[model samples]
Target: MPTTAFSAHYSRELDVEQLGWLLSGDRPGDDQATVADLSQWAGWIRTDIRCSSCGKTGAQVVRPSKARGSQAVLRQAHFRFVDHQGGDGHHPFCEFYGNDTGEARQTDSLLNFGSEKSAETRAVRLLVCKGIETGLFNQATIRAMRQWFFDMKSESRFKVRATPEALAWARSLQRHPSYRRWTFHPAQAEMPAFDWQAAAKFQFTEENLALVELAKTVVHQDAEWKRAGLMAAKHFGQEVFNTAALQPYYEDTLTLCAFVAKNSGISFGKTSPDYYRFQGAPIPLLALCALMLFTSEWEMNTAIAKFARLLASAEPSDLSLGNMIGLNPFHDYAAWRLVILAAEVAERSLKGFDYQAQLTAIESDLRRQHAIWKSAG
Candidate 1:
């Protein structure tokens, strides 16, 4: 008996009969395996499939017996290679086989169980500003921060008072000794400049708890990743993304990106005036602006003013968020991290935001710009 490495690529769970048609000697017409077709098979138990890697035919889907009482065991679709007397020969060097070959097989083990690799080993190295560690800010903090900023930007009048909830959270944070040295005056006309030195010195206090702590050292090297990359894409398994893990790394930057994307009416799709005002320009550049406004360490008024300036001058490109995720600089952990943050921002913005008011403001601003241009002419 040989064991086969499970591949997530075959998303469809094939019954004995359907699988027979696929593995049949007679060529079948027009239907190739697709992720969409197999997507429904995600939680279903599959059986009687062939292993594409080992050329092992009639591999039975293995699952454990159902549990009793309130304790339910999750059953997964997998395969164990069994050779019937007349069946096709199994690959002599099946990676999934349990036998110890008595050789230095670190490479083989990693290749076989790559997806099962723990985050401790696979944790991505990030260039977080020195003071920040994991759990510095949580989702609740981000929502309040973004909402406060949004209110500051949207309200027309001077010094609109903060809600008790907003003021309370802010006051509580300031009382913490780690943040006491840093000035946080949201009412100030200018954004507080980021003090990288102060930011760099932050250490965890008993009051604040982080979800995912920063890794001690880099374990899986890029060289190891390059080697692992050579394996077929199917073995990589589904990327287990924990957005909470990114919260400590990103802080408020994530929420800000989301606010810009949602309020600016920029999303991932082909450009149009209805969805994105600039029909042919780079949408991501505006998103980049949103992230940068917060990054610039400016206060509420200055950050809002900077974004207004961007809307007036920035041009659209053929690029989108989906497009940016595939390109360099934007690609990698930052893009995924932003995806989580942006989604969270967008969701919150939809429920509580005054989109109609924002739209009216934009239209009025556009009219003002037109008048200015005409006067100049």
Candidate 2:
């Protein structure tokens, strides 16, 4: 069983809570009719839902049945795989395979270990920072950390903070170590300064410059490009237009370049409105470049260059590229594929450690984490 599934219609993953909200006709901004009845909703889930990890259809959403004229709720809704004639089902690597219950228990326990101010939490944060600085952590460790951070935000019961220095180190390593949404948390509020400083000081090697030049010659209309742009804009609070007219505009790219150039100064800090305005521009561009890799017309050199620019922009500290790609490794098989492609590119072009092997290790660790949790449970 799984708590999250991907909805093809939305081009994004939705958790059981979001699905239940939609089925109750209370989804904000959703104009479509919803099935208020749990039974009907379960039928719809069978038809519409797919395993986020395996991308296989036939996953069913189960909600606690409401007694006639009663209001008490007993349990939360979740997704479970249904039996099919063929062996087509969740992949062996899927986190939900025979370990959902234990995984959930372990995740909850780990997340609730301490509060933001506790010594335990601080020790963990320091360990993460040290691991990043010394290159002691691999892709598996990074993936585990990313999962922990993501669950902290989504689950609502846990709230943890990472120092700006820790976040900067994580970003320098091309790993996202924060949540998707920026809140009023003090630590989060203080991050833009560190992010801007890192971006301004970003050094582009000769190879990086050449790759950027190469990327300029490659351009084509990919639907994923538009979707990436729209989602990025939505994430950063930028105005979005209709998808029909949303293509990669030269002006937007130029604007991004200009923003990078102008803000690449020592004086620009969090207080500057422009810092807030363009701090997040690179993320969408990175998303675009990542999606391009999946298209038939992808260019490896071009992707490497775009990824370089994303690093120079420095706004990715608060957002996960995996999440922006909408193929979280825990839920979507495509995420593993994307990681493999990205690892290959990074190995050849990007600086840092053996990210190629490290990225692949994320899948292994995800499986291992489930097994450990199941055994402990």
Best of the candidates, lDDT: 2
TM-score for each predicted model, relative to the true structure: 0.19, 0.27
lDDT per residue (tens digit) for residues 1-377 in model 2: 45446665544445454555555745443233222345666656666777654566777655433345864333334466654653435554344444333222212111211111122222222322332334333224333433442343233321112222222222234332221222221232234444421221222212243333332222222322232333333223322122212123222333443444354342222334343222322222322332323221244545345434434442222110112221222221112222222323333344444323433454344445546665666
C-alpha lDDT of candidate 1 relative to the true structure: 0.30
Badly placed stretches (over 4 Å) of model 1 are 1-48, 85-89, 99-377
Q: How displaced is residue 145 in candidate 1, in Å?
A: 46
- In model 2, pairs of residues that clash are 52-331, 52-332, 53-331
Every candidate's lDDT: 0.30, 0.35
The regions of model 2 sitting more than 4 angstroms off are: 1-3, 8-13, 17-24, 29-39, 62-78, 82-96, 105-327, 330-377
What does the lDDT read for residue 98 in candidate 2? 41
* Sequence-dependent TM-score of model 2: 0.27
lDDT of 2 at 158: 12
